[model samples]
Target: MAKRDWNRRTCAKRGHTTYAPSEPELRERLHVATAAGEAWRCLRCGDFALGAPHGGGPAAEAPPVLRGKALRDLFVLRLLAVERGLRGVLGVLAAWAVWKFSNSQDALHQLFDQDLTVFKPVADHFHWDLEHASVVDTIRKTFDYKHSTLVYVAGGVLAYSLIEAVEGVGLWLGRRWAEYLAVVATAAFLPLEGYELHEHASAVKIATTVVNVLAVLWILLSKRLFGLRGGVEAFEAERHSASLLEVEQAARAVPAADQAAV
Candidate 1:
């Protein structure tokens, strides 16, 4: 009776021959052999392990490659995240402006109503016109600085900012509900965006409208939202089929008898 070697026992249990060299040594050998256009032959099975350098049992499979629509969908999700993030930032700025204007109503009114005798002399020196009644009137009307109006605007902007932030986070995390929310929100703004374009056409306005429209369409069609294009079942099936683990298992499947024998 002799003390059983654990390493040999483990190898026996796995039904594979164990190499004496360490992993690093095996890797180096495999690397050199592969560069020379020769395969690293396995000791137990007498088969070329090709690129496998680590003990030559089974070659490590590469991660599942996302191609075609899967890759496009991921890119779209990131794009949506960026768009939502920008909207969130704009909402925050708007909210801040509302708060500042609301708090400075008295100061704003005083500055606008004060006499401009000294400022007129300075303006004349600089060849500036301080007597533009239309400009002054517009400024006064725009920044009436009503506390109630400011409060209401700030509340609206704050709520919108929260929604944008939530959509950004959810889209970034690739949540399904986030996709639906993004689609709905973006679609809701399309009509307003279109009307703005009709009122005042500009490159920025056109680009924004196009991007939002495309985003809405992509989410609806690609994600199979609202019972379109085979719905949720098909969408989930596509995701499962594209999974790395699933791909690897399918590619490396062996017969039951072969697995038992191994």
Candidate 2:
């Protein structure tokens, strides 16, 4: 029989008081222990404890809060959201520019009369439309000597497209710099989009404008984008749960090894 002193030492290490069980009580406890048992070792504290028969208190320390990776991932998501919103703004701008230019007889005429044969199918394709004829005629009469306007619009589009390209690539690389750049660029165009909707008042225009506005709000407020969701402690708790599962699996494997030994 194990000495009462040894039992007391074991119980003390486990943060419990020891009491000798009667024969019947010992059998009952042993049966319960075998059903729901856990074995643990605490080195510095010199403790070796087994789980209670049915359940137990906390087994490990609480995990630390999320810090580094949490912040970085939030930044990445924020940038990605900003990039999306910016691209949406750019799209609206491109569409508006096309709409305004088409309405201008001078612009349409200039574009229509250009050597579109160079672009093959594109020039010939839209030319067949009756509206295209009106556009061509309008441009010829309105902008007779202002070919410079066409040059300006083309240059502006090229520059804008280049900016979009840079933002998109940076976002793909998960850079926070790209996110800030995207917010600045897209915000700059909000007034333009608003003015366009006010002037045109079409369903299509209104929908496009609303979409960009909401996109901006979503990026700014989403927990994942803002880095306001789970903290470091949450991440550590998950890791700890995984560790417990691994330990339980290892314990089960032990009996299999003993059987193989026999």
Candidate 3:
């Protein structure tokens, strides 16, 4: 069975990137004289694309076109960005809820009391001790918080939401600073997440923790963050080498690659 080419597959969906190489040797490898004027090899999919090159420049100035593993890494980053955006939106909603609750705590408590009264008969039938229920006790504790305290809580949540939203946008745009920001921000709150899990274990919390851990680990290693795996230098070098143009450039050293292209 043949292995799949993710880069080519992605290019097929998104369209190919072609370049006109002004250098004689570079153009010889990339351009083929077709009856339809000319065909230049796609820098991404590596297929002969019949169209005017969108841009032309010296070989050294050719745009960096990502392929293979580099494209996969980009997909992962965008996916992670989506997750961050969802979490950010949720956080904002929660903050707004807390803010509203703080403003109308007394009215909300009255409504809660009425709801509880309505459910009294059902609770008795089920032999549920509503008065001493842990969940009810926890809910009641919210009423004891001062308005200022609630406002502060809401502010904190809103701030966290903003951070996540910014990180999401940055990662989606493939900004280098965003990668560092994501690592620092997510890792900073890990201790709190662990503590929350320790206080009350739940499948959702466990899953969230696992996802966050895996994200942090994957970003650090795959992106070579914090000097791991030769750091930014190695990461850049690897990305550069993945380009079809770079592959062809490397071929100049080995004559066999030219024949192989034929």
Candidate 4:
């Protein structure tokens, strides 16, 4: 009887429940335990891992190297660039949604509510006569006053918010993936931005185009995305050394040696 009771207790301790634990429950338990447990902390990121991916893996024993100011600056720039890129994308989406639900409003009317040949070059280049296009007619025909294009607008806002939020978080966490994503997303919209500038050539359009180009350049050149190893770090080290020397000199400077010694 004693041995049988002990076996049952042992089985219970070993997770021998009548029903299997759901994934979420198991995950929650693991998370709780990990949070309470002591583990190795990453020097660079301050993240803790339990013995790395594989037992005694290469990553488990490696020490985090010090990052230089250049690398840190690159990280910071990446964060800002991705955030701005997200905003740019959201701006496009918002514009698209507004156009979609405006009951086939003329692009010229939508652009600035002034009747001008600003879009003429675009129409000629694309052979798209917004004035008499069948697609425009169909859109107008299908339009209703009660129609709320708010759905598209809401979707665009939500998508933009979420994407930007993710990129922001990834950037804050120093993820390399976010930098690439920012670059790709920004590059994808260059053509559209160029077109917009060409269509209107307005101050706003020009500023938008310039900002996007600068952002791309910042991510590519300043951030040192996909550069050879140690290059960014070396730059950072030089910057840090210069700063340290400045600080040291400031510390050594005396205020007229208190005048008595002089």
lDDT of each: 0.69, 0.51, 0.91, 0.52
Residue runs of model 3 more than 4 Å from their true location after superposition:
253-262
Q: Candidate 1, overall lDDT?
A: 0.69
True lDDT of residue 129, candidate 3:
96
Clashes of each: 0, 8, 0, 0
User: Any runs in candidate 1 off by more than 4 Å, and if so which?
Assistant: 1-68, 112-136, 248-262
> What is the TM-score of each predicted model, taking all chains together?
0.64, 0.38, 0.93, 0.39
Superposition TM-score, candidate 4 onto the true structure? 0.39
* lDDT at position 132, candidate 2: 49
After aligning candidate 4 to the native by TM-score, how far in Å is the CA of 69 from where it should be?
3.2
Model 2 has an lDDT value of 0.51
As for TM-score, the candidate ahead, 1 or 4, is 1
lDDT of 4 at 48: 42
Q: Candidate 4 on 1-262: residue-level lDDT in tens? A: 4323322333334422111122332222222226546343322222344442212212213222323343455456655756565775776677566657565544534553233257657877898886677865655553433335545655666666566666666666656677677677768879988887777689877887787677767666654666633556754545454332223233444443555577
| Ten contiguous residues minimizing lDDT sum, candidate 3 | 250-259
Q: Give the lowest summed-lDDT range of ten residues in model 2.
A: 57-66
Model 3, 129-227: lDDT tens digits are 997899889889998899999999999999999999999999998888899999999999999999999998999999999999999999999999999
RMSD (CA, Å), candidate 1 to true, equals 13.5
